[model samples]
Target: MPQKDYVKTARPKPKAKPRASNARRGNARPTQGANRPWLLIIITALLLGSFGWFLWYLKQQPANPQQPPAEVSKSKPVVDDLPVKPVAEPYQYIKELENKEVQVEVDTTEREPQGPFQMQCGSFRQAEQAEAMRAQIAFAGFASAVRRTEGTNGIWYRVVLGPYDSKRQATADRNRLQQQNINGCRIWNWT
Candidate 1:
């Protein structure tokens, strides 16, 4: 194949229109728009009339007119007899429990003394669940015991953490378990 030589062709330049003389430019024809004097007058008159009407309407009435005397009722019902409340007397026995000492009398009807308190974190039907709860409690730095108790409603495995000397200690342990995201632990007397 022979390689042919390519020649670049020149493009035709566009000619500019000749500028008119200053005198002819000044005398150039105005736009041939229709003479609408009636339309212009009517539009101007309407705008002025509407503005005047709005002003007149505003002046005719107040922004907030006072209500007439007949519209407002002068009579309001008066309370004839109001109930008299009896003065509340302060009860004598609401002393500060922490500051005051409470003495319990030993009664003949009381057969046995109160036992140590215990906290039961969970009660499960399966022993494995009880063991898991105990393991969770152990991870939370608590030693727990799982006991299998047979009742009317089948057997139940209880996860307990007690034999606490006082109920306060049991409550504290329960609160600590709650802090470890273990909830629903109730403190009761350990049998």
Candidate 2:
């Protein structure tokens, strides 16, 4: 069997056609005119329905009440036309306090010369007893001291309560010492 080869042939190109101008189509007026009847129908229906709704809403409202008096509606206040009130003096209240009698009592007893005071909790011949007293005083929240002094008999250790600022403070220390069952506490003057 023999095979045949196909030959390709070129045809002439198609001629360019001329297009019609839009001006010659007379501006397409008829199709636009056809839409007007339906558009008018829709607009008329909307207007009638809105008029019906407005009529219904008008019937739903309550009857109007009598109008308010003109004087109450005026923007300026009636108080502005009235006379002003007189104000009382600012310091008038102080005169009442000045009239009341106040009696002041002054202390007559001379205060002791300003020196730190001390309370003697115990006088012991033994240093250990004095140290023990000092420890007990410290545990009771007071700072105490042990002073060694030579007496007529021998050197003694004195457990002192405080170097307090005033006699009343020293008295309070003596009371505290009494609470601790050491009733022989004495107040002493110290510079």
Candidate 3:
């Protein structure tokens, strides 16, 4: 084969076609940063305008000087009524209540406790455990005592609350302990 000289012809570079969005918008195509400064300027102008309006509004308002708190006066209250209302008949309930003996007849009579009530918080074999429980109960604001009682099982230490005058009082104390998350307190008649 005869040697053939080959020429690498550089075809005209294809013109970069405009993007579809840019082509549709034409000259209105937004630049990466063109509106940034304008936005800042507009926002700044709005803020300044608002501040100026606030200053003008403040100037328009009548200045109310702060007055010292007035002492309660013993004078009759000033009424601003066109028609003088007949002085409201003086409150008669107070006078009637003073003379009236309100006999509140309690309909239900609760059965009273037979004797002084007591609350037994816990019975423990060890004195130390009983003392620790008593300390915890004391922390909750109740005075408790650890009494050592010899039972058929063995010597047991009882953590007792009180010789409460009433069952209601003993229940109240137990409820208070319950609020402190202490459970298993039994109310018994104190010997």
Candidate 3 residue 61 Cα shift, in angstroms, is 56
The clash count for each model shown is 0, 0, 0
Strongest candidate by TM-score: 3
Model 3 per-residue lDDT tens digits across residues 15-109: 89966776576766688677689888999999999999999999997667586555766786865779767877768898798899877878698
Q: Rank by TM-score, descending?
A: 3, 1, 2
In candidate 3, the residue pairs with backbone N, CA or C atoms under 3 Å apart (3 or more residues apart, or in different chains) clash, namely none
lDDT of 1: 0.85
CA lDDT scores, all candidates in order: 0.85, 0.82, 0.87
In candidate 1, what are the lDDT values of residues 1-191, reduced to their tens digit?
Answer: 98764543355558899998756889755554556577888999999999999999999996667855445446865556978775874664565554788799877785555779888899999999999999999999999999999999999999998799888888888888899999999988877
Quote the positional error of residue 154 for candidate 1 in Å: 0.5
Sort by lDDT, best first. 3, 1, 2
RMSD of each: 19.1, 30.3, 21.7
Q: How close is candidate 3 to the true structure, as a TM-score?
A: 0.43
Scored against the true structure, residue 98 in model 3 reaches a CA lDDT of 85
